[model samples]
Target chain A: MPPSGIRRRPGGRSARVRATVLAAVDALLAEVGDEGLTLDAVAERSGVHRTTLYRRWGSVPMLLVDLLDAGTEDDWRAPDTGSLEGDLVAINREVHAALTAEPSVTAAVVAASFRSPEAGEALRRFWEDRYERCAAVVHRAVERGEVPPGTDPRRLLVAATGPLYHQRILLGGPLTREEADAHARAARAAAASGLL
Target chain B: MPPSGIRRRPGGRSARVRATVLAAVDALLAEVGDEGLTLDAVAERSGVHRTTLYRRWGSVPMLLVDLLDAGTEDDWRAPDTGSLEGDLVAINREVHAALTAEPSVTAAVVAASFRSPEAGEALRRFWEDRYERCAAVVHRAVERGEVPPGTDPRRLLVAATGPLYHQRILLGGPLTREEADAHARAARAAAASGLL
Candidate 1:
């Protein structure tokens, strides 16, 4: 085993290995869906040692959870466009782009969440963390007197994004830019009318 | 082979076989999820011949599609509560009950949809059909001057149900009856305010 006393660097070999492994997992998920993913395939595709992967991830679901966690870390800043409507629209647009840009990958990750308890827990945490992070936008809106003081940020965000998710994942509808805009506008209208 | 001239009854042996096969598919999906569902396993569980199963369903995805189709046929009627708000609340409550009552089955079917193109298409059709059947509620509301003429029923319905789905499936939140009522009320308020 490597010495535990050595301080790890941010962009060191360990980070590179993790990045490569996650990328391999992403590719495999896109190609074969979550049901077909295997640790051996990930090892071969990532050029990581099988023993290392087994020791680190332990199972395919754990590896998927790690991939999801890594995905959540990639720049999900709450929009601050001076108005709640602008921020809501921007965030909804971002979600629409992510879901539609790579449907297979998004679908596979969601399917994995439903099929594996570990992945499901990770996905739940991912959404909760995202909601918590984005709650600041609503807080700022409340401070600015743009919305009610007691407005629920998580509920508002869910309302803004839920229809988009329903259209893309559940109903299999075309997730157009206009649809994303409409979702944002609807949420904004509801919030302004004290409907949220 | 059976004679082509013989008329088939609705609930005859063929129907029984289909029901048994679909039930087996549902059971296996709940037990092991989409990844573990197989034609051989379904045949064994249903006590049906392997050749018959192959000839009828052909693949696991197709079998899942059949199961979804069967589910859709079981009594989904729009509530005629004489008011749009009442109807919306009733529908949302039903959605909440269905999602929470048998979460495993719902999760498995949704996962199957992500992993299979055939299942995805079937799921899409299922929602569309349900939407069509329930469009009457909105039409009645329009006729009663509750909602504006030319109101999109599907949009209203999506708004009412999207949050529940996001909470139950994506965010993994507890979908309570109060939450269901809240969703309906929010959508009703939004629609009344011309947000939806």
Candidate 2:
């Protein structure tokens, strides 16, 4: 039923099937909310069989988590912008671009993560990894005497992302490219002064 | 029908009824969640009839907004601690106490706020009002030569609250009294350095 010669393997085509189902689930979530997303709809959209979808993910939350797993956080490796200010501006721009690209999807994922513990755990890992990556960049800056060593890398990572999300949800701002750059400049100044 | 003598009039008695309904919604949201809450449950729990609940609030989100309205940010009057450091520390403690006292409620409200415009508007009003109030304190400090006049009040407010929420959600910290004091110190230092 799904695009020709794709028979189920006896050994368990589980990995491939999971990816397909997750893609479908992402599509469904983007179109319909958590309340409207159903296993049948996902199967229909993803081209995966209903049995396959159910066999892999037992519930909506579980399916959502799988989709979340498929998408990772943006790479946090520090930019070599030659200055702390330039590095922060690059990071902030990336964040605003990501959120703006998928506003509704981002909002739903955020809401889902808050409501489900499984989603939260996965989301936490994603954030931790991102922060660690970003922290490495800040570390280099400290070594170069750009910032004080006592700077909390974790707080800096938060400062980079916090304003974007805060303004997106709270202020209904455009989250435009220009604003992201401004945030980066501000955060870099804040951090360099050892204030953050 | 609601507890025998509880009148359901719109002006005086209805105000009491509104309060009772809001309390019920708060408890329900904290216990069950947004999806699980219903008019029937509110009626049964609040002892108000179904017809009355429907007549007052048109939908679940609307009801949630009303509950949020009842809990509006009223503690915005800035305190004069004669210095930025003292003022920030005192304000941080107040915020920490509020969030820690009702983490679940705050989480639910935040999640719902992300999805609903009404909730988002309510949240914006709440945070903006608080920020403006806190900014007034910073302004007073600048007036007294405690901090530089060029300091951005908006940025200062975000940095102050950022860590409190970060610890609560990401690090899972206690957001205790001592920690609030620490936050105040860091935020004030940042403010003084013109980073905030």
Candidate 3:
């Protein structure tokens, strides 16, 4: 077994191996969806042998959970746009890009979550952390008098993101940039009304 | 072969077969989540033969789609509550109940839609049809001058539903009755501001 619980490099491999494995997960998701994604395929695609892959992640579910965890920390740091609308627009755009740019990975993770409590827990934690951070932005807007003092910033943040997820899964759409803009505007407007 | 493209029971056999199959699907989903759900399991649990199951739905995806289509017509119907908020609350409550009550099925259908264009298309039809129907309730609010003119009722409706889906998938929380009420009010307030 490799030291530090990571394999694929004896002495040291750049942290790039993690990224490579994540990309493999993404690619496999795009090709096979959720039910068909397998650890062997990930190992082959990642060019990391089965032993290394197994040592790193005991099972497909564990590997997937790691991949998803990698995704969460990639770009969750939202841009500071100053204005409520500007911040929302920028964040919405970033989220929209992430979900749409890798629709397959996003969908596969969502599906896997349904079957694996570990995946579900990972997703829930990602959201809570992300939402809490995003809520800070909305709260700043309220402090600036851009929105009503009574606005539920947490709920507003969720409202801003709700449509894109809905369209992709339940509503069946690509969640385009235009759609992101519309949802942001609507969420901001609602916040301003002290209703969110 | 049985009549009407489904495996019909022998003459005078009770309609209980279909009901049993559906109940079996629901049970499987609740216990197994999406990945663990399988056609063979459904048949075996329901005490039906594999031939009978295959003759009824053709494939797992087909069975899932049919299972979704069955007994769900009344679930999506919008209520006439004389006000947009009231109507929205009703719709939101129904959705909350449905999701919380059947997380397994909800997760399964969503995951399947990711890989199957047919499932994706069916989800689209379901959303558009239900949203259009729900929009009528919002339009009624406009007629009452409760919301501003030129408001996109459809967008407003989307705002209301967007958070529920987000919270369900990301927050790991239950869709309580209180959340539904809050979403309806937020959606209405957003609409009144011409945000929709």
Q: Top model by TM-score, which number?
A: 1
lDDT of 1 at B5: 25
In terms of DockQ, which candidate is stronger, 1 or 3? 3
Flag the better candidate by DockQ, 2 or 3.
Answer: 3
lDDT of 1 by residue, A1-196 (tens): 2555235553476777899999999999877877778988999999999898999899999998999888688887789999998998899888887678653677677778866889988877777888888899899988988878878887888888888888787887777887687778777777766666
The residue-level lDDT of candidate 1 at B193 comes to 63
Model 1 - which docking category? acceptable
Candidate 3 per-residue lDDT, tens place, A49-90, comes to 888778878888887788767756776666678899999988
CAPRI band of model 2?
A: acceptable
lDDT of 1 by residue, B53-139 (tens): 999889888998988788679886899998999999999988888678643676667777766789888888888888888899889
Model 3 spans with C-alpha error above 4 angstroms: A1-16, A23-47, A72-76, A102-104, A148-150, B1-51, B59-61, B71-76, B102-124, B148-150
Instruction: Determine which window of 10 residues in candidate 1 chain B has minimal summed lDDT.
Output: B1-10
Candidate 3, residue A143: the lDDT equals: 82
Evaluated with DockQ, which candidate comes out highest?
3
> Candidate 1: how close is chain B to the reference, as a TM-score?
0.84
True contacts kept of each: 0.53, 0.18, 0.70
Steric clash count of candidate 2: 0
- Residue A7, model 2, lDDT: 61
Number of clashes recorded per candidate: 0, 0, 0
lDDT of each residue in B1-196, candidate 3, tens digit only? 4575354545334356777887888788777766676778987899988898888777767766666666445465579988888888888887777677655466566666655667656656666777887878877888999888788767778788878877775466666778777888878877777777
